[model samples]
Target: MSEFKRAITAEDITRLQVYSDPQFTPDGDAYTYVSTAINDKNEYESHLFYKKLNGSDATPWTFGNVKNSNAQFSPDGKKVVFQSTRSGLPQLWVLNTDGGEAKQLTFFKNGAVSPAWSKDGKYIIFNASLDHDDDVESQKEQSKEERQKQNEEKKKQPLVINRLKYKSDAKGFHDNKRNQLILFDVENEKFTQLTSADTDHGYQDISPDGNFVLFTANLNDDADYELINDLFTLNLKTKDITKLTDGKGGYHSASFSPSGDKIACLGHEFAYKGATLSELYVFDIATGERTCLSEKWDMQLGDLMIGDTRLGQSTTGPVWSKEEDRLFFIATDFGATGLYQVTLNSDLEVLYKDDNHVFGFSYDPHSDSFILGISTPTNPCNFYQLRKTSELVRLTNANAKYLEEVHVEEPETLTITADDDQEIQGWLLRPYGFEEGKKYPFVLEIHGGPHAMYGQTFFHELQLLAAKGYVVLYTNPRGSHGYGQSFVDACRSDYGGGDYTDLMSAVDYVLENYSFIDENRLGVTGGSYGGFMTNWIISHTNRFKAAVTQRSISNWLSFYGVSDIGFFFTKWEHGLNLLDDPAKLWDFSPLKYAENVETPLLILHGEQDFRCPVEQGEQLFITLKHMRKQVEFVRFPGSNHELSRSGKPEMRIERLNHICRWFEEYL
Candidate 1:
């Protein structure tokens, strides 16, 4: 139990808050990332922490102690503009980057996000909701009052609207005014509306010349094709909005060259045909011609890399060096992470290649150098610089300082060939107390996203499980990213079919190769799609001694009716509906074989989880109880589907504890 200290305690779970979203100061000398912590008031407070590249004492900026992030220092590095919920709905706030009390920047009742600094740092341009007071329940009361005022003037009109079938995973609602672009004068504290049409203008990039702004939007266009997010340029002086990339094709990753003569943009669009791959394109601003740079390039993870399944593709942030011809960026594909430098004049060279992952790189044109954050399988994150001698310096030792008391294990990668000769790869975490010849209880962890990849990063739960003497094995199945599009789309309609086979084969490989894994005391668990797999595992066979499913889906029929993406996901993944595809969906559903579940099962859910609503867990529990199966249910009050990642700190710890306790009791 000594090593079990990494196992989250109730207090730790109760106080849990996750941090993300990193932004760098223009000079690359200082940087800031969003951190959520509990202040004296015990509220979930988020603040911006700024640290110098030279490893100086990091200072906390912003006041009132509410959640804040998406910070961008002004061009001159004098002030910072960010988003916060201090005034109810998320609004814009500006603060001095050096240190000072934060000042309110926007007062829209709807919301604002992703604040970008203007060219001269005189004004801030942000994307905000123009008018959406009528769509969501949080704003229904205000809408009712406005509707009543409208009724007083004229005849009442029926509300018949057709808009986004689903707004966003973050913001729910089909109806709302398009997210428009607005420029706010920092000096006068006034604002100038940019675009007027009912459309969304995201990625408001001010051109290098400071005379115009380049952005991507799908205004007055079909979502299917233009979803590539068409490029548009707004003249700061003339206010003339000109469409940059024309025709049916879409574009993203748009940025202006140093001289503002040429543009580097991804001219490709994504298709919903199971999997997609985006390409890099260069558009000459004056001539309006595009060239596909993805040619002769592997362009997928694992293809050009050599680390692990962390392989494939060159999806990374772009930084133009002081020399406009030289572009620096990080590239990945099915294996390892690689940093590259591309010259517009027909030459591409690899700068650095290693098993460690490199993301969020920034280059300071004045210094002719770069600074970025990176991590590997065994390393916690820190910042580094590339200079005269390839010098690497740590900026913020955020984890090691706070997590010194806990122990984390590095995962080992292995390869196993399935029955059909299919090659599969995954990481194995050994129990804390390792005895070479002694067998240990084993657990197979599955990642959700089915689309998202579980790279070589630190995961607290996996560490706790390993510390508890459980051999943890997790793999990038056919449907996981980091692989090519065909590989990821392989699990689309074959959830319980091939994907399950890949999992079972991995388990078999682990049992055969690892002498320390107990054959009799085996278990499996996962969340979301992974949760769905956990339930499927328990119902179809008694191979596992016990099981725990979090935010799971039991019946595809119910999932298609209640989940946020039910309507489309059911058809896209299962290829059927309640009536149209009832047979296939039910066949893959875990509930159909509830009577076959002989092993004890524990069900956990979050009350506010709209993705795979808690109802799914409740239904599984109820059906098992009806079938006289051994089952227990735990509900996290005020928690959401993301309990494992960003739910309450205490609740997350509690979740890890509940799963551990259940396995300890039954396995």
Candidate 2:
């Protein structure tokens, strides 16, 4: 080992770099990706970077403080198109590989994103939100004065709430606009509106021949109340549309097979409602026959599991192989996310498996290799190359230097059998410079989603706690993914029942096996579902000395009506609507038993959060204060539910500092 390094601190999180959206070139000789880092202004800036396949050093392709991402090479590999905010709004910019400045492609009013190149490379298609009644040209023709006048008149008008779904978490109110496909003719510089539907169209992929485009949309009359994502293909020549998937389940992330006769996507048929594991499905374009590729795998496809440090990267391309007989994708199994492959012949295999998280990857059929964006407990994020021989090559050392100067304790894995015979997966991190036979303070960190798993990913908060001479323990209880569908659905309606016992069982197991943990000085903290659990734990037990609940839900009754997805999520998870049984919702609520809380509790919440509204925290805080219990509520001014992961940099650091201060005071 090198010389003893300093303990990791909250400020170090701002220095961490996040890498994502790796896209391989057509010839498989080079690849482009986005590297995001916090700048001096405390803002995250993403830039484009690339490296050659022949062991060449990575070079920056784009430079700036603005964010640039979703880069993909043209079919001819002569030009690269990406979305960037360099022009004040996210717009398409194409850069020639051999040289000069990148040219702006679109000036759409709502901006453009997710650029997809056509097979012939003559057209670039992208998605942009547009007003339902106005065309792009008409909107552009309006003067600034006229637009300001219309906005003022609209503000004076009464707010009409017509749609069942009106408000979103990050987005305040749902505008009467839709995301439609826009085709940009590269040679002529012409923009054409493809679809004029009221429903939002989610872009999938274009056909190999470039004659058709596949997309997902819920175009039903009752789309607001129903969860139905149907696949449709729009013909380029005839301008005709064809529906591919039946209204059976929610399907998305569709990709066209190389031969254009089949489409594979990830979706669930509401088998277990919101907790249903996403399975891979192949739909035959010629016969309309659909096959479930991962019916027997018993694993959740894609990366729904959450980590504290970084936001989740999208799982890309069910990337069909050259022959189009097999497909490659990512799956979360046990406690790690790995690349997996499944064939039409029912053959399934794990291509890459390790105790690390594979956020995204791009496969090149010509080279039979993959460019992966992966992370581990110690590393923030980096790019790597994986060959058929299972050999791994590091492509970027984005955080290697800073990491070498800091100490990140490795967590030991554990599998504890719960009281009801379910095995709970967990990990325990020892304090930095841990001494043998010395007892240390312990903190139980819970994860959100209750449906989200806590696994082999880099978590900054946990590391900071461990660096502060505290043993950090985290686990995936009954409602977590990575374990099978049945285990994930176990805690659906039993919020604090078996799942609570499962978490308690983990703590008990760790205390029994690790004698260095000071059980009496234990602390508990989590956000969202984890926050809900933290609240639930303190109300039910006095074992913890201090607790921090962030962006958490204290009352299910209020969550059913106030949350962004409350209307549907409540019914899906609890099997009860607000009108069905209010008493039952209250029974599972954490606030119902808040009067029993005896631990020193700290509540952290984002003021503008809409998922678990700030009101959830306010209600809990007021209840505790009224009861004369030890409590403190800290509110972040302009953050949403994702405050912990993607909030403003300065605010994120302050949130971390508050967490540490609260624990230091009582633990």
Candidate 3:
């Protein structure tokens, strides 16, 4: 280690840059990606950056504090279309690649997003929200102040509830607006409404010959109670709609082949309810036949690795080759995400596999190469070019300066056998400044999702703990993804049972093998599911000196009704609803055993969090306080369950500091 290097701090989050959505130009000469970072105002700023294939420095194409992302080049590679918030709301904007001012392309009322150019480059397809009773043409005539007045009037009236799914964590209560498709004619400079259905639609991909558009939507009458999303195609000339997938299964991330004869997607039929592993599927356009390509593969498709450092969205699902015989996609297995290739005959091959996280990638069929967005434990993100004949070439070093000044610790992987003979994977990190024989306090970090995996990604919270002189440990338990199907489904219907044992087994394994960790000075913390485990661990035993729970569920009885996904998620996970078996739900709750807690605990929650809901934290805090136990509660204003991941920048830093402060004071 160099003497000039310094330990990382919670505030260093502002200096870290995140990269995503790498796209190569049609000519394959230059590529563009989105780079995000925190500004002085404590807000996120993202911009599009462009670079050539000849090892040139990347330059920013857009300026200012506004977010610019999802850049797609035209077929001829002359112009780039992207989504931007510079117009107050997210809208479509176009910029000439040959150097000129960017032009705002859409003036829709609710804003247009996810712009995809047609094959001929004469039209652009996007999605926007529209009310059932509202006319698209009339919305353009209405001024911003007029819309504000109308919204104020609507707010004065009481909200009438009629649907089961009325609220969500991302968007609060449901409104009358339903997302619909819109087509923009570049040559005519006019807007045309494509589909005016009452249901929301997702824009997937445009056909190669420009005759059809692929989308996903549920038009069933029982859509309010159903969870299935079926793929559909809209004919441009006839304005006709055709269903592609069977109504029994849910599908998404669909894209047409080079010849437009087939469509590839990632989906499942809910074989294990919500725990089903996604499989690759191909549909014959002419015969309406769907075939499962990866039926024998037992891994989840897409980037399931969870981390707090990633900012922008990335490309997932299947990307076709020039010959159209092979397809490329990202899949999760063990603890890391890797890029893999599959053929129509069900042959699979690993294209890239390592201990790093492949968050995004852009494939160029013409050159048979890819621009990959990868992250490691020490690096937030960087772009790399991969070729069939050459080794991985580093394209952009976005965090080179930060890495040079800070010292980050790499973790040692561990495999522990559980009480049931099941193997659990974990990682251990020594304190920033450690001596060979000196003992240090240990902190056990648990990841949320009970379905998401903690892999080789840059986690700011865990790094900060290691920097604070605490030996940090994180693991993938029974319920985490990246493992096989049975492992992910093992935690369901028995929350706090096998999953709890797996975590405790990991701690025991570390303590028995690692002599430098002090057994007496131990701390634990987790968010969401991990938060639930923290509460469960402290109540079940007093081995830990301190604990912190974030956005956790303590009472399942109340959680069944309060959370946005409470009603259905309860049945899907616990295998029973509140009305089905109240006793079982209450028995699995952490609050039921709150009287046995002996360790000091800290409770943190977001006021606006609707996923787990703030009430979940409030219930546990009130119960612990009434029991005269050692507990404290901290509430973040205008935050949600994603406070640790994509919450407000300032709030995220405060959350990290609070976690470190609590552990430091007690441990």
Taking the tens digit of each residue's C-alpha lDDT, what string does model 2 give over 1-667? 2137989888886788788888888888888877788898888888888888777888888887888888878999999999998876788899999888998887776678899899889989999888877675543423457657877998898878888788887777788888999888889888888888888899899998999999999888888878888889999899999988777788898999988899999888888888999889899988999898887888888886577666435455587998899999988889999998888986998899799998899998887899888889888788889997889898888788888899988889999999978888999999988989999999999998877788888988889999988999999999999989889999998889998999899999998999999989999999998999999999999999999999999999999889988998888888899999999999889999999999999999998899999999999999999999999999999999988888888889999999999999998
Candidate 3 backbone collisions, by pair: none
Q: Write the per-residue lDDT of candidate 1 for residues 1-667, one digit (tens) a residue.
A: 3344343233442233333445557876766766665556545677777877676887878657577877888888888888887776677888886566788777664577778876777778888776633222132222446646765754555545464344333444444577777777878877777776666678647887678888888765566222446788889899998887664556666788878887776545445333455556677888988776665564442222212112111225455666778777666555455567778763777766666667556566766655655666555455566663566656666555435555567788878786677787788998886778898999998888666566566566776778788999988777776766677778888888788888899999999988889989998988898899999888777899978898999999988878877766777677776789688888989999898998889999998787898899999999999878899999999887777766665676688889999989987
Cα lDDT, model 1, residue 99: 63
Q: What's the CA error at residue 604 for candidate 3, in Å?
A: 0.7
CA lDDT scores, all candidates in order:
0.71, 0.87, 0.90
1 or 2: which has the higher lDDT?
2
lDDT of each residue in 26-128, candidate 3, tens digit only:
9888899999999888889899999998998888899998999989898999999999988767888999998988998876778778999998899999888
Task: Please give each candidate's TM-score.
Answer: 0.85, 0.97, 0.98
How close to the true structure is residue 172 of candidate 2, measured as C-alpha lDDT? Answer: 74
Top-TM-score structure, candidate number: 3
Residue pairs of candidate 2 with colliding backbone atoms: none
Flag regions of model 1 displaced more than 4 Å: 1-24, 38-43, 97-99, 132-168, 173-177, 221-228, 237-240, 243-252, 266-268, 272-274, 299-316, 330-332, 335-338, 345-353, 377-379, 575-580
